[model samples]
Each structure stands twice: as structure tokens, then as C-alpha cells.
Target: QVLCGDDRIDAAVTQVISNLSSPFRSGSLLVNKIEAFEGKELKNVADLSAVVVIKSLADTTVRTVRSSRGQSGAEPVAKLVVPALAPTPNYDAALKQLIKVCQEVHVPLISLPGFGDLAQIADEVRFTFLRQLKLNSTRLHTFLMNLVVEEGLEGLVEEVSNQLNRPVSIESAQFSLMASKNMGGTPASQQRSLVDDVHKSVRKQLKVADSNDGKDWIIPTLKVGKRLVAPIMLGENIVGYISSMVRPNDDMEAIAELLRPAALAAMIEFHQNRQTGPMFAATQKSLLRDLLLGGTLAASDQERMEQHYGFDMADGILVFAASALNAQGQPLALDGLPDSFGVMTEIEGTATVVVPYLANSGKTWQQVAEALQKQLKELVKQKPGGADAQIQIGAGRMSETTFDLAESYREARQALIVGSMMHTNKEFTIGYGELGVKRLLYLMIDHPELERFCEEIIEPLESYDEEWESELVPSLRVYLAEGANLNSAARALFIHRHTLRYRLEQIAEILKVDIDSQEVLLNLQIAFQIRDMMSGSTGKRG
Candidate 1:
């Protein structure tokens, strides 16, 4: 009975293997037996049947298995199985099956050879994955080199082109991708709106609707027309817009994928360059302004100004004092002036109005004076309360030499002072020559001391009012004019020499001084100079 049972068991097992190899029955019968024998009272029998089923399935697939008995008569034996070839058709499904077989036999670390084609496929997939991860040219280059090492350059190029969708050309200097476009039957180069179209396409491709839009997935596309404009964002701000003329192709994908990293780098670099340019320009202008207004200049600075701005020591320079007035004739602040004529008002009490006088003629002073006067008048008239306001100008003379500017400054200041005092409501005034010193002195006739001095000097023959009167002042003046020659003085005065002597003695007696002494002569000369100074007369004097 035991021998018959063993023979029957062997026949049943052989029939099971034959049935498992049949294409239609193999996969189904293996799966059914696994499901049916999962758990039962006949656990050992079920386990043995599961092992037979797994081995039969492994034989059809490119997989291997090793069976062994447990040591010391353990209840269950352990079997090891590994896939000799890479999983066919479905890797996920095949891997799951291999794991299931190992679990049934309680195997550990089943060694299996990878699929025949898995190396190449995995490599390509890895390249694509690495390409996606890279965000710069350097990384991309490294990936390309690795690809070339595994599969030569030509193969790499073909694979990358096929994967990305564009025509890729690699050169020593640069890598480029080219795509043809037909815009309204016009050649891309000749199309006037090519740039616009491209921009629109890029924008559209990148357009993202707001959250209010119901779509769950976002489609990223390059828009080239009015319909599409997608902003390239950096942080929260849009740095630039990207437009593409070519449709997405395998080659184009590779190019764009390559360009994405490069584009980001380029954008950052471009933004930095843009910011730096304006800063540099602003720094230059600030330096120029400081040089012009700082009141001090270095030797190099002076040379630069002279060469670039035509400022030279030989240029005739003058200073002028000017005050703006309102329509009411009241003084207006310097801030009210227009921006022409390089008007610069200093912090000092006065404004140093710069007027460029190109001509070498003496009349440059007059021209500048006239211009200032005109501007002042116009400013006064335009002011709100300028009717009563008076615009006064004091212009200094021009000097060919630079050192004389101090003199010019003094002249202008004096002119402004005297002009303001003497003339009322005049728009401008010139000084020194316009109003004589004698007349100006008479205006101070109320001063008693000056009157007393004049009276004392004209005394000795105050009653002699005639031109021929032998007045003490006239006598002394004549004597001094003749170099203190009594004879010549007497001749000039039409008096006898003795008579001149007697008159001089009388003059000295009245003036309380010696007639022949050097001290008295010096005193008299000083008095004469004082009189001339007070009178503002250039007339000849003894």
C-alpha cells in the first residue's frame, strides 16, 4: 500500500508540472493553487504543493530557484530562489511574484541576475532623472560626460535628441537648438512681429490661471501671441518673460531642459548687471556734483575741469550781487529763481550768480549786468506782490587775471551798497563813477564836525569872497603847488613876494603852525589829502 501511494504521488507531481508549463494553464493554475493553499489543516501538504508550483512558474520565466532540506529534521524545509534574468514585461509584477515565492519557502537574499535589457533602459531613465535634477550648466555637462562614457558621444546625442524633441547642435564654442517657424507664410527672419509672436507664445505656454479656475492640473506651455504671457518669477517678483518659437519636441525638450538651468543663471547675472550699471552712473554724477560745489579743488580736479568744461585761469571772471523782488517791490529769496544760467546760491548771505562771458571784449561786464537786470525785472514782475519791489544789481568789472577777482568782489559789494542807498526804485546801479564823491559828501552836510573842519580851513580871509581875494586856503594851495617857492607862488597869485610872505605868516598865525617848519608842512599836506578824500575829487592839489 505505501509503495502504491508513493508511485501515485510521483505521477500526480509530474502531471502538475506538465500542466503548469502550458501557456494558458501555467499562470492561472499557479495563482489558483497559491490562493487555495494559503492556510489549511494539511499545512505540510499545501506547502509542498506551493513549492512545486513556484518552481514550475520559475522555469518558464528567466528566474532560478534552489531547494534544500532543513537540518536536524525541522518541521519545514527552506528553499532559495532567485531570478536569473531581469523580470519580463512588467517589472513591478514580476518582482512581486519573486518575493512571494521566496516568502513561501522562507528564503533570504535570493541572488538573481538583472533583466537582459534592464541595464540600458535603467541607464537611459537615470540620465533623464539626472538631467531633471540639474539646475546649471556645470551639472548638465557632468551628466553629458557620464552618458558619453557609458554610450559614446553619438549615441548620447541621439538618445538625448530623441528624448527631448528638438534639433540639437553641439559646437566647441556653444550648444544651440534651432527650430523653424512659419508666421503667416512669412519667413521667421523676415517677419517683423517675430519677437512679439515669440513672446506671446512663451507667455501663453507659461500662463497659470488663478485659484478661482477650476482646473486641478496646470498645463505649462509657451505662448507666442496675445493669448499667452507667462511671467518668469523670481521669488515673488517677475524677472523676465520667456518665449519659444518651436513646438515641444524630443530634441527641443533636451535643449530647453539644458537651457532652463542656464536661463536661471543668466537671469540672475543679468539682474545683477542691470542694478550695477545705474549705481555706477549715480556714483559718477555724485562725484561730479561734489567737485563743482565743494569750493576746494585738487590740481588734477582743476585740470579736469579746465579740459572738460572749458574753465581756465585766463577766463575773465567777475562777481555780482543780485536780489530778486516781488511785484510789490519786496525782496524775494534766491530759491525763486529759474534754473537757467547755472545760478548757484551759496550758504553765505550772498548769491554767486555764474554767467559765462565768452567774448574777450570789455563789454562782457555790461552784457552780464544787462542780463541780470532783465532777469531780475522779470522775476519781480512775475512775483505776487512785486509792484512795489525794486530789483537792484551791482556788477563788478571783469579781470583777465584770476587774482583780481578779490578786487572785483569788493567793487561789486561797494556798488551794491552805494547803489541801494542813493537810488530809490532803480532796477540796477553802477558805482563810483556814476555818483561823484563831492555830491555824495554834500548829502552828509548835516554832519557838524565836517562843517566845522571846512569852515576852519577856509578862514583867515573869510570876508574876501572875490576870485582875486588873497584867501589863506588859496595862498597855501598856490605855495604848495609851486613846491614851496615863495617867488613862484607870489607870481602865480599876482602878489609881491614880500606881500606873499606877510600873508603866509598871517596864515600860520591863524592856523597855529610855523610857516617854515617841515612838521607844519606835513600837517598841511595831510589836511589837503583829507579834503581831497572827503570831496572825492581827483583835482590837482598842493
Candidate 2:
């Protein structure tokens, strides 16, 4: 009978094998290996089987023997390597060599043919081997069977840590903490956030544990550090990761093997949750699209949104559009948005975040927008490529009720377009109230006639870049914006009035129109708007 209290498997197996009956032993003719550790207990047992070697017992010249013991199992209960029958003079040396070979292969106990009538005791020895195998299997299975009923990710991780006698944690693909074991028990000095720079030090100490590797996992153990991080993969995709704290005396290989089943269980649970989660999110997204595009919400629809999205629209709601682009200005895949007070939906390949607003008693909309801006700044900071991604947030005025959400969405979208054209910096948040004359132009820029008329008026001045490229166009825009005030225009352009006059003359000379003509000024205004619309480049001139 085996008494269990987190005892090592090899130690238990060694104790059981040593207690076998004397009939299996060679009495007075003692084997040096078996008698070597007569008083002390065996610390490790590599193989737990009684290997039998016989000359010409099988039909082959030389054979590594396998019994019926390991047929249904992974490891052999006993392995016997038989050599060619040799002369009596060399028999002792041959036996010694066979014994060394058994030790090397980790076969715990070997039975020799010449040792005290081996045929007479064969049946008894086989019975003992079968008993030992059954006992070991039962002990391991009982422990593992208890782990099968672990309910969720926390339970699974806890069981794995218990089995391996170490701390473990599970993190999502983006390195957000999901569940952890023994984290709370750690002394404050050793505990740190997993995403911080300290994690890099932990990763640096890991070395490949198994050189005969498989593609399924990269199992590494600490060579000098204090933790181990392994991937929890779903097919080729690493859906999550598993990590554990390591002690100086810990067996790295054993710890890695222990986490294998936990990782698989975690993956299965993640897959199931993903499969069920999207069905609910899909319904929410569809309703959100309707609410954003149509300026109407029924009583039932309001209740559904509250129940599913948990947003109270009685206070107010703000609509905002957020888009992410890579450093190269191409759209990047955006995920992991804050979904508490808002629902993110795609409109023309851009993401629209619908924020449910609650008024702070007497706060103005500007104050509210500033608060929202701070929250958005924090949200961006949480993203993986937050710094590299060019994020644009365009918000609409706060609509007092759900009925005005469609108008708010349109305003937000226009803000995204017009604000982007008005500013050079890609990262910005603007509201509809802030848009000036560009807002009206924004509504009309889509017309082919507007584009053509602007192109016709400014094409000469725009095309004549080398002659007076920088000075003329800017001078004309400033002069027109300042209402033909020569001093104001000159001050805005940071040029003398005479120089501004010279540039204005150059502009009129190219366009073949008088600068003071009202029709010409209107055309020039439309031309600048067209240029802004066509280029869609931010950082507009004064």
C-alpha cells in the first residue's frame, strides 16, 4: 500500500521494488549494484521493471527484450538486453558489461539467467512486476482523476500548480492578466506586473529544455532566472500564455511537462467561450449600427440596449469615430476596445465608438469633451502599439436623447474628415461645434462641380509653383481670410505689406483676375477649399 503526501514517483517506486521477496534475489551471491545502497534509501528510480535476459530464449542474434507488461502503456515495465552466448572464461566480463548497460538505460532491477534457478522463480517475479505496475498506475490515475472536475480557468491553474508544487499564471494574447495562482501569496518584493520591464529579465534566463523538440510547444526552463513562460497555443495561433515561478532547486523539465495538460485545458475553455461570446456581441453590434444610423429608438430597443450594453441613454450619449493607422498610414486591425459605456462598430472600414453620456449637473459640453478626451488618452495608452498607431478621435455634440443619435453620428463622421484635413497631426479629437466654414464646404466637397470649379480657378496659381510657389498662394489665402485687410494679412503671413502686395500681384498675374474682385475672391476661397478637400492633408495655412 502506498501512502501519498506529495511524495515523488521515482522514490516510491524504488522503495516498493526493494521490498520484493528474497526468491527474486540471489541470496549469498550478492550483486554489487543491488547491495551498493544496502542501508540508505534509493533517491531515484529510472526504470521500474524486472528485466530478464536469456541466451537463445528468442530467435534473434541480439535483442532488447520487451515483455507483455508495457503493451497498453507508454513505458515498459521491464527491459532486458540479451547478448550473444560467449565462452565461460569471458562470461563474467560479459555479465558485468550487461549490468553496466542496464544501469545506463535506467532499468532498476535485472534478472540474470545464471542467478539461482531463474526459471523456477520466473512466475513469482512476473507477478510482482504486474503488482508494482498496477500500484503505480492507480496512484497516478487517482490524483489526475481528481483534477478532471476543475470548473474553470482558475481551478485548472490551481490544480496544475498543486500538482507541480509551483506558482502559475495565465495571460491573454495581449499580455493582460487572466488568472493566476500563488500570486497573492507572494512576498511583496517578488510581485510585479507581468507586462512591465521586469518580465524581460525573467524571459532572458530561459534555455531550451528539450533539444528533441516538436512544433506544438517551445518548452523552456529557467537556466538562471526565477520564472518560466510558455505559449498556450490553438493550432498555429498563440491564443494565450502560461507562466510559472521557479525556485533554485526545482526540476525545470518536470515543471514544463506538468503544465502541458493545463495549457490544453485552458485552450479548450477559451475556444468554447469564444464560440459562445460572439453570438451575443453580434446581436449587440447589429442593434448599435441601427441606433447610430437611424435617429429612432423604441421603448423595447432602449430596454434591450440597457440590458445588453448596460448604457443609460436618459442622461445623454456622445458619438465618436476612432480609426487606427500604421506608421506607413495603412489601416491596422484594432481590437480590445473599452466596451463598458460604448459599443464599437465599423462604418466604411472605420470604427465608431458610441459612448453613453451622463451629465455632471452643470458641466458645459466643452468640459465634458475635455473629460472624454482624457479618458480617450488613457484608452490609447492601454493599446499594444499605442505610440506607433496614428489614432484619430472625432466626436459629435452630446445628444440629449437617443432620437438625436443619428445626427450626432453624422457630425462625428464629418469632424473626423474635416478635422483631419485641418490639422497636420494624425492624432486628434475634435467636435462638430469647432468646425468653421469648412463644415459647410465639407457637406458640398463631394459634388463634382465644386471640385471642377475650384480646380479651374486655382489650377494656374497651383501649377506655377517654381515662380512664386510658397509666397503667393499663402498670401492669397491669408488675404482672403482676413477680409482683404492688408495689415492683418501681412501680419498673419509674417511678411511686410509691400512683400505681400508683391506676392498678391504675382498671384493675380498668374490667375489673370483682379485680386480685389468679389467674384475672384469667392473663386479663390472655393479653390482653397477644393485643395484642402482633394489633398485631405492636415496642417492648413493661416
Candidate 3:
């Protein structure tokens, strides 16, 4: 106020500032010069092109007056100057914004105090900026080296989100989600939409750019990512990215700078993850195998496993074996099923699940297995060829402890095999306890005597059915299974009672056995069981 109140001083100062700020066509002609050095404004100088080079920050925001990563509205000057602060809103905002942008791009932000000529101030700023750049490089170097430690990529993103008051996510080059925080609990559809939009824009850039786009470490400044984003690169290959979860809101350049440390941190994590991911997975899988197949787990491993899963070794577990396929009939991987679904393993194309025999949460192990299957169905439906996927599970009796799991695994496996063989026309979930007489048959599933007995009793019916294109063996098995009741047998076979009676007569005549004898009926039931067991048992039958 005092400076402006003095009319002579104000006039003199205004004239000096105008002369200092302009070099061409200033006092005698119209000022007609513009100086932009590689998309950055040279503050208080007409061409710092040879003085200081500026760094590019992927100009993600609109390349207009608001872009903090580039000089869009401001013009170059011929001498050192600072925008004298004012009360107006536009000047305040622009001045503060330009100061920040220049500081970040390492452009000189010079100030003039008492008694300094324009040339003197310009000389001083050149030296000051050089020193500040060296200092900034050192500080940034230190900040990036120890950016992330034990927090991991997930923790690091969460931390960054907290600091920025915005959501953040890291993803693979293919946009596979790695870590995220503060992204609303929206459905997967919403999440995928967000990723799709961002990736689509990035792909366009990748497609249009020349061959040497990233070759010289120059990533094109994005113009249409709804959120602030930076590529996380390893050499020329983009391993992944660090990005904002929401749309831009004035902190675009600040977010870009913040993401650099995060990208560096993520780079460290992704590098280590790639290096150790498979080995780590193999180790965990092997451990899961040992737990399911009853191999010895070292004491520490056992204790850790017990604590990790919150199951006690003394209480024992229920075993479940499941076979699943995609709609294309390819084996489904169930090991990495989300934790919300109970833990399960895909061992040789079969899901082997073990749950505590009794969960204090009041849920039974069978309920847990059912829940896992339900979740798995939902999970696969999100993938291609998932609607027609087949999933059949079998259960074994509850075991006494970890020591008894092997027996349970064997029972569960055979139950699946035999049930699949018997229920060839439909899907099934078989339990060892529900096998009835088939439980005895499965015990001898690999026995030659069992195979021969089945062949002796049912081979004639099978051959007759094959030759006549009939279902004699199936009808007879159903008849015997229904306690030789003609009405039930006829209903099951979808035929009339008289037809079933005639079929029974043919069976009795062919086998040369009495049709009304209970002894013969029991033998027929046993023979059917043998047929299913022998037909279903594959290699490694127990």
C-alpha cells in the first residue's frame, strides 16, 4: 500500500519492471516475443534454452493454462522478477501455481529485493537454480531409495492414499490388479470399467507413438487419463503402473511427483515379487500337498500352518476331493481361491480341501466345503467358458487328527472316481458314508476278483444291450436296486410295469436264476456295485 501510494515511486518501479521483463519491441515497439523451453516457461528470462534444461513430467492434465507440468499461459521475461502478490483470486491462484510448477521443473523462480538491477538478479538466479537442482536431486535420490520396506506394495499404496487423501492402485502392464486402497467398494464390473478406460487410452498412445517412444526414456505425457497415472517401468518393458483411483482435482502435477516415489517403491516390490513369486507359490503348494496327503510337516511349519489357518492339529479335519472343469472342459485351478472362500488346493486337476472337523463358528466342515464350491461357481462364471463348467465333489469321514488325513484323502478320491463312473448320465456329489453297499465295493476296487465277479453277473446283460441297442443291464440294476419292486422299477426305467415284468423274465431266463428269490436279488445289487467300482477306479486306486 505504501509503495503504491507514492505516485513517483510507483511510476518509476512500473517502468523498471516493464523494461526488465521485456527485451524486444518494449519501449519503442510492440512486445512480440515468446520463450518456451521444451514445454516449460522460463521465469524472468527470455530464453533459458542454453541456461538450464527442464525435465518433462508426463503432462497428464489438460495441456492448457491449468497444466502444472508445462508452461501453458505464462510468458518468458528478460530479467529476474516475481509476481508481486495481489488480493485478486485469479492472480493469487496463478502465481502460487506457477511458482510450484517452476520449482518442480527446475525452472528458475527468481525474486527481486531492494537495490538490485535486472542483470544482477538474473545472474544470481542462474547460480541459485543450479545449486537448488543439485540439492533437489540428492533429496529425491534419498527419498526413493528407501521408499518402501516391509509394508509391501499394498501397504505402500495404502500409505500413499492416506497422504494424498485419494485412492491409489497399482497394476501390471496387462492391468492385472496388484494392490489398491481407498477405491470404493464397488463391484468388479465397476473396477474393470475403470481399468478398461485407463488402459484403452494408454493403448491408443502406445499404438500411435513412433518406434522410439520410450527408447530414450521419454514416456508421452498423457492427455486423457481420468486419473493421474504414471507408468512403472523396468528397462524398456513396463512391468506395471501406479495410478490414482479418482478423477483429477487440481493436484495433478503433485500427484505425478508423489507417484514417482511410489513407482520406484512398486518397482522394488514387483521386481522382488517376480523373482520370488513362483518359488514362493511352489513352497506353499508343497506344504499344502503335505498337509493333504499326510506328509510330515516340520514342527515349525506345522505350528505356523495351524496358526495361519486357525485350526488345531488335535481337532482333526474333514477331507473333500472335487473335480472341476471350465466350460471348455479344461481343469480349473482352485488353489488360489479367495480367502473369503475357504482355502483349497488344486492337486493334479482335483480340488483337495481340508477344514477343521468342527469350526467353533458353528459351521460344519461339509457346510464349509459347500460354501467353497458355491463361491468357486461364482468365481468361474466371471471367466469365459465358465457357465458349462462341471464341478463334482466327494467327501470322506472326519479324521481323528492330522495323522488320519491320508485315509480321508483316499476315501474322498475313490468316492469321486466311483460316483462319476456310476452317475455317468448326470453330475453327482458322493460321500463315503453315503456309498451304502458301494463302500465295500470301493475297498476292492482294484481287486481282479471284484472285476471278474462283476463281469460274470452283468456281462451277458451288457452284451445283450449292446447288440440290441437296449438298456437291459441298466434296467436290471435299477430293478434290483428298487428291492425287486416292479412298480418302482418300471417308474425308474420310464416304462410300464408289464414291460418291466417281461424284462425281468428275460433276465431270469438269460441268467438261469429264479426271478422271485431274495438271495439272487442281493447278489445282483452287489454285482452292480462291483461294476461301478471296477469301471470308475483309475490309476492309483487305494
Error of 3 at 311 (Å): 1.1
Clashes of 3: 1
Model 3: per-residue lDDT, tens digit, 158-215?
7788877888887664345778885523333333344345334544555555456643
What tens-digit string does per-residue lDDT give for candidate 1 at 1-542?
Answer: 12112322332111112122233211111222222233322222222322222211222354344445467755654454553543333244443464455455443212223333433433554455346454444776566555545554344435444544433222110001111112122232322243234334433443433343633322233333321212233322223332333552223333355434323433333233323543222222222322323223345533543333233734665567666555444556543345344333321244445444566655656676776776666655655676456666666666453344446555565566556554444556574344444334545645677646655554333444244454667778788768889999999999999989988887777677788998677556545544554544422232
Greater TM-score among 1 and 3 belongs to 3
Estimate every model's Cα lDDT from 0 to 1: 0.44, 0.58, 0.58
CA deviation > 4 Å runs, candidate 1: 1-296, 304-309, 325-329, 335-342, 360-362, 401-404, 431-542
Pairs of colliding residues, candidate 2:
423-539, 424-539
Query: What would the per-residue lDDT of candidate 2 be over residues 375-467, giving only the tens digit for each residue?
Result: 555555655655576667788888876668788888999888786776534767788888766788887877898878866888777667645
Q: Model 2 off-target regions past 4 Å?
A: 1-286, 295-298, 304-315, 333-343, 359-384, 421-425, 433-448, 468-470, 517-519, 539-542
Clashes of each: 43, 2, 1
Q: What TM-score would each prediction reach against the true structure?
A: 0.28, 0.43, 0.43
Candidate 1, after superposition: displacement of residue 483 in Å?
27
Worst 10 residues of 3 by lDDT: 26-35
